[model samples]
Target: MPRLFQVIGRQEPVATVSMTVYLHATSADYAAVGDDYLLVDSRGARGGRGFYDQHATIWSRDGRLLVTTQQVVWYRVTK
Candidate 1:
């Protein structure tokens, strides 16, 4: 599986992040991609206090994006 990273926030004029994601072949005869976290417990990845923004979204590999919801608190995708 290719490595992936996800930043939780809205698209800003200035990118304030350090992460990247990779893509792999799917057996379904199609291409696909998504975000990843080093640990299931993402709060460990944050050095300081954690934060969450309802208006925030995510960017995946190939510069694709996944829409977000203000009422939604967390999002997860798996293959």
Candidate 2:
């Protein structure tokens, strides 16, 4: 998502060689009135291979699943 990019870009400056892709949304639930939610994200990078991935999930305050996302990123290696 564009918003995600904006947030990430603001937090840290990413290298020009890297790329990010939103793979898919595994689940999503509509929030009801006066409902609170939480966003949890987990990410990992492969050892200097220019490959990275991220998994993000949104959960309701009551611990119910709201949404989940899968993302993959790649970077160009230069000698």
Candidate 3:
């Protein structure tokens, strides 16, 4: 799991957790592309100290599913 959490620097995650996307719905089909409005919704949670997780979904104006993503992150503050 460290392979998934490590990205940029040498920072390490002492604790971590995973989350799943709850809902993703679409109304219309956007197979033919031209121009359309994109909508997004997201929600997340934090352990209040070391880690947080979030997921988001993007949809076209006609309610076509465009993209969805979820991520877990570990962070620290230093000066």
Candidate 4:
């Protein structure tokens, strides 16, 4: 299994917001394969005169990374 950690947290909404992630994990046994690495995921939102962002990282079994994904979502709120 992989280990996941949240590097960022949600904040207030604003005009614009950005989230960044850095994958820097290493493994000895798993690192033997090229598919070994760290996976980072990030998300953010802007609304209500503020913005919020969050990030998460997941490593594969033996602390290796083989799969990766990215998702961006936007929503408009009327208040």
**C-alpha lDDT of all candidate models, in order:** 0.30, 0.48, 0.57, 0.38
Give the TM-score (vs. native) of candidate 4.
Answer: 0.32
TM per candidate comes to 0.25, 0.46, 0.49, 0.32
Misplaced by over 4 Å in model 4 are 1-16, 26-49, 64-75
Prediction 3 global C-alpha lDDT: 0.57
> Residue by residue across 7-74, what tens digits does model 4's lDDT show?
12333223323334444444553456556454545343322222333335566646554343332323
Q: Write the per-residue lDDT of candidate 2 for residues 1-79, one digit (tens) a residue.
A: 4233543454322243344444233434442514554656555534245545656666556666655666555544332
User: Clashing residue pairs, candidate 4?
Assistant: 12-51, 13-49, 13-50, 13-51, 14-50, 14-51, 37-65, 60-64
Query: How many clashes in each candidate?
Result: 0, 0, 0, 8
Q: Candidate 3 has which clashing residue pairs, if any?
A: none
Model 3, span 1-79: residue lDDT tens: 3332343345454444554554455334444434756787765644346566767787777666767877676655342
Candidate 4 has its poorest 10 consecutive residues by lDDT at 1-10
Point out the higher-scoring one by lDDT: 1 or 4: 4
**Top candidate by TM-score:** 3
Tens digits of per-residue lDDT, candidate 1, 1-79, equal 1112345333222222333333333433122432342112122222222222223344444444433223212223232
